[model samples]
Target: MRGLWRAHRWTVASGALLGLSGALLAVWGNPVNTGICISCFLENAAGALGLHGNPRMQYIRPELLGFFLGSAAAAVLAREFRARARGPGLHLLGLGFLMAVGSAVFIGCPVKAMLRLAGGDLTAVAGAVGLVAGVRLGIALLGRGELGLGGPERPAPVLVPAGVVVAVAVLAGLAFVPGALIESRTGGGAQHAPAAVSLVAGLVLGAACQRTRFCITGAVRDAFLLRAAAPAAAVVAVVAAAVLVNAFTGSFSVGYYDQPGAHLQWAWSALGMGLVGLVAVIAGGCPFRQIIRAGEGDLDAATVCVGMVLGAALVQSWGLGGTTAGVPPAGRVAVLLGLAGVLGLALTRKERIA
Candidate 1:
């Protein structure tokens, strides 16, 4: 027990903080089971920026901005902000878009799925299973030297950090200036914690997550790839902490029906998260991790963030998003195509026999 504590104490702390943050954010006015959902928040930010015209889905979330700016600050202070690009290809962008689509179909990202489970939503189980399966599949392919995107290189000094500065300015304009961005007067887009509160929460989370390298899929990935106990233990800590908070906050609802932001298409939920897991593995990060890394001056991650925002917009514009009614036929088809495309990418990627 002492050895385990020595190895996993920091992870446990990070996970506890993350879990408490999610639950408290929900209690503070963010949507239940959606305190730190990257995909959903990205979609909201896209709408606010007029990337999509969904009146019911437009808001500039300060928490989202804090994720980037705060992570950037952390990276800079830690002297870890070295701008590096992945090898040639639009592959990362495509993966990012596909990741968003997958999250849309599932109605949340891996983090949110876990939060939902913590809130006692049984439906998230399918998504969790799918994520594990997808991560396992990625591990298998990686083991065989398939789908190898080459290592990062070409350390441009100011590329990504400069872009992050621009993003901060632009996003701040939209967030603070009236008429600069559209806003939803109703629905989920209208629901949020106070901007100051959310931003502070986000800043704290970003710094902590960056410092700890916390990621839902990465945790699962490390468990498989390195047989590490700390990562998995961190995840368990998240669930346990959130569960305790949910129970105390009167937010725990132990059932599948009428759950907020959930769909009845269990198989599709699994597949959607499977796609998320697969793309996250290939891209070397999940949606939240991508945002953090982008702030850290990883141009590959920045490109992926751009793709994710584009995807967030496209899902609404193209009507490819799943709903509480269930995944539309188009959403299902899109997931299928995404899976096929992933397989194609794997087969076509430059082989590096491991």
Candidate 2:
């Protein structure tokens, strides 16, 4: 098992498998235009709690529950489940919130941005460019020794699993007993793929991602900064696999502007992801990495994940998120605030460069 894990081919293959499976799951009826989005799922879950009233997007997503649990299981099995913290709490939470807000403005995270592109959303191209720009900026900050918040000292071993259990219970309850507060009757909001299928897919993908350490931000960062092609290669494999599946499933549409559930504003899309990329670099991992780390018992990552969920809720509730028609007023303001925050973090940090 160790030998197989150490092999580069195995890692790449697993990443490809994860990407293909996630895309297929989306095509199979997970959510139209949102097969596997952590941010989107969190937003949906928040709406399920009556945090927001967007009826078409409210539901308890099984995939998210599967992510934490799958990661926990893998960590335990691999003997790598060590609870730890590295940076400050409040700062991490703030960054996580900003990341979520930025992502909402663009309507996806770095992973979903790639998926959106593969699904023929041209707006994602701009988002991709933004991601690259943000990563580059982060690299520059790192060169100057500009680091953001640090975490707590002690780590709680049970927090992750406990959280997962609670989430699962919530989802199960919602699935079985319809609540008046829960928006289960909205058009795009109330729809969901089969719970069994979504759970299975999340499990598979989570385990695969945990094993391979797949991260979109890290892939781009390593490629540009370290000149290493391995992580980038993994991304290529996933993209290729997803594109193939999308084509096979007749989910492929080619264009930047006319894709489903996407707006044509190129600049904002780019800026939105750029903000995410920058903060992710400062945070020490991409959003996907954070999810995987939370599985491995990293409390800081878990905090970030929590912040992301809250941020999603705040964005949707305040009308700060984007839609297919265009960027919302609140979303625009959130983007501006995010950009300002990043710049402030960069400028205010006192670091000693070698």
Over 4 Å off in model 1, which ranges? 1-5, 146-148, 349-354
TM-score of each: 0.95, 0.91
Question: Candidate 2, which segments miss by more than 4 Å at Cα?
Answer: 1-8, 149-183
Best by lDDT: 1
lDDT of 2 at 71: 74
- lDDT at 330, model 1: 85
Judged by whole-model lDDT over C-alpha atoms, candidate 2 comes out at 0.77
lDDT of 1 by residue, 1-354 (tens): 457557667767887888888888888888889887889998999998889988988998888888888788898899988888854448777888999999999999888888999999998999999999998888766754636256647777785477775768578646867777888999999888887888888888888888888888888998887676766888888889999999998999999887999987899999999999988888888899998888888888888888899999999999888888999888889999999998877776565556
